[model samples]
Target: MEPNRTRLIGEYIVGPRIGSGSFAVVWRARHRQLGIEVAVKEIDKKLLSPKVSDNLLKEISILSTISHPNIIRFFEAIETREKIYLVLEYCDGGDLAAYIHKHGKVSEAVARHFMRQLGISIFTFWLFIFDQISSAGLQVLQEKHLIHRDLKPQNLLVSTNEVTPVLKIGDFGFARSLTPQDLADTLCGSPLYMAPEIIQNHKYDAKADLWSVGAILFQLVTGKPPFDGSNQLQLFQNILTSTELRFPPGAIEELHPDCVDLCRCLLRQNPVERITFKEFFNHRFLGELR
Candidate 1:
């Protein structure tokens, strides 16, 4: 049976469904007494395969421990025999993908603002993940370990509670914890934002996320992905073989040269050659913003 709209899921009063995925449904809900709004993701265990259910629990575990202003806030989670509900901070302003769609690419000034926050958030997230490892006196194999396997515009949300919308990275469903010695072989995430190594089924590390950042930044300034094809097969082939990215005739003229240069560095096909997060953080493009 379908859950009632006005039914209370723990302390939250469920409202209309806000979003849905293959494994879960998100509802716009409000705290009964506090009156604060939230997004409650309801996952029907009966509908989920055991593997998917395990991953969902893992996502909850990751989110519950993370606390960052630029990352989505996780309030709490409740579970029943048949379903699990995650109460998350409501970002009424929606996601970066929809924002880009409406604006047809943002101005460099706006892109600069968003990119700075994105860089900080990405760097900080790794810091939080590594803090525990470092505290245990374990050797830190790499500058980065945790990978947000599905970094893209859609996973980035903007909070409407502020005077200007504040961007926050959301959706931890595809996030993974790895070390330099460990590499991910899972072929996940959107094809357009995927790194060449991921498309080739190569063992990828945190650098793969940096490649996604480049694709997102390129789309932010150009209003389109770097590569386009009629199907996934062609898209993967193009990504594997394409060495350079070309902007539309006038697109390059409108962006700062440093911005274009950063994109190029991040999108390098060779993961070993791609700029590290430290280098990217100190890049001229982001430095100019300061």
Candidate 2:
């Protein structure tokens, strides 16, 4: 599809297309008067169902409230008769998924740095087991009971700095709010990162986010996901029944032992057995890093 180059969105001048998804198209834009670069997400209301539109709106609303150094910043929202434009901070370094692809098996020290930062930014870190990942500015969202259902490397944006890039959690398209007692039934998120409870179609809460975090941490250290299969059916089967996680050979000896322990606790099959946020924060794995 040919993109329109002559169009101006609000006070911003659209540049090249940076990203495209089923619900929206993101463009690199420069503020007309301020001369600052920002990302503009354009969503066509006509193409989305009412439910989908509501989700998108919720994402914008959630972003509006969250302001963390490790979370994407929302500038403004512009609406038209048939479309919605969301202005957000642009991360020139792209996402963690791309970074991992380019540089396999990040050093343990680097991973610890990123994980510690993410751990601190989390708000309302405990709820029967739900712990949202990243950003001191994200507390308001947790107080409101919102959860980022899809927590993966692709959704984690990286700042431009190569030496020590700051990872900002972005893309709240699948984010949703649920009360402490409520369990989310929707089986959403990437197949590779799906928590065991999710694959079983069992009711899940924000605790599911922790499982995803574990998967991401594992992949960052090992250069691959904990589980693998030839097809979706097999993958689902493995996730549902595989209770034990097998790390790469010599991984424990090669990396910090505490790091391995944290992954095991986070990846526990039983939701009740998973590490609580309080325990996680105080654990030697992260505490020692300080």
TM-score of each: 0.88, 0.89
How many backbone overlaps does candidate 2 show? Answer: 2
lDDT of 1 by residue, 1-290 (tens): 37553699999988888889887899999999999999999998888888777778778887887766677889999999989999999999888887888787777767766777767423334566667322110011123356788889888888873334777888888777787688999988899899998888889988898898899889988999988889999998888888787787798888899989988998999999999877876678876322
Clashing pairs in 2: 121-135, 121-136
Q: Please list the C-alpha lDDT of all candidates, in the order they appear.
A: 0.80, 0.81
Clash counts for all predictions: 0, 2
Q: Tell me the spans in candidate 1 whose CA falls farther than 4 Å from its real position.
A: 1-5, 121-144, 161-164, 288-290
Where model 2 places Cα greater than 4 Å from the true spot, the runs are 1-6, 121-144, 288-290
Give candidate 1's TM-score.
Answer: 0.88
lDDT of 2 by residue, 154-260 (tens): 88888884946888888888898888899899888898888888888999987788788889889988888988899999988887788588898988788788899
Candidate 1 lDDT: 0.80
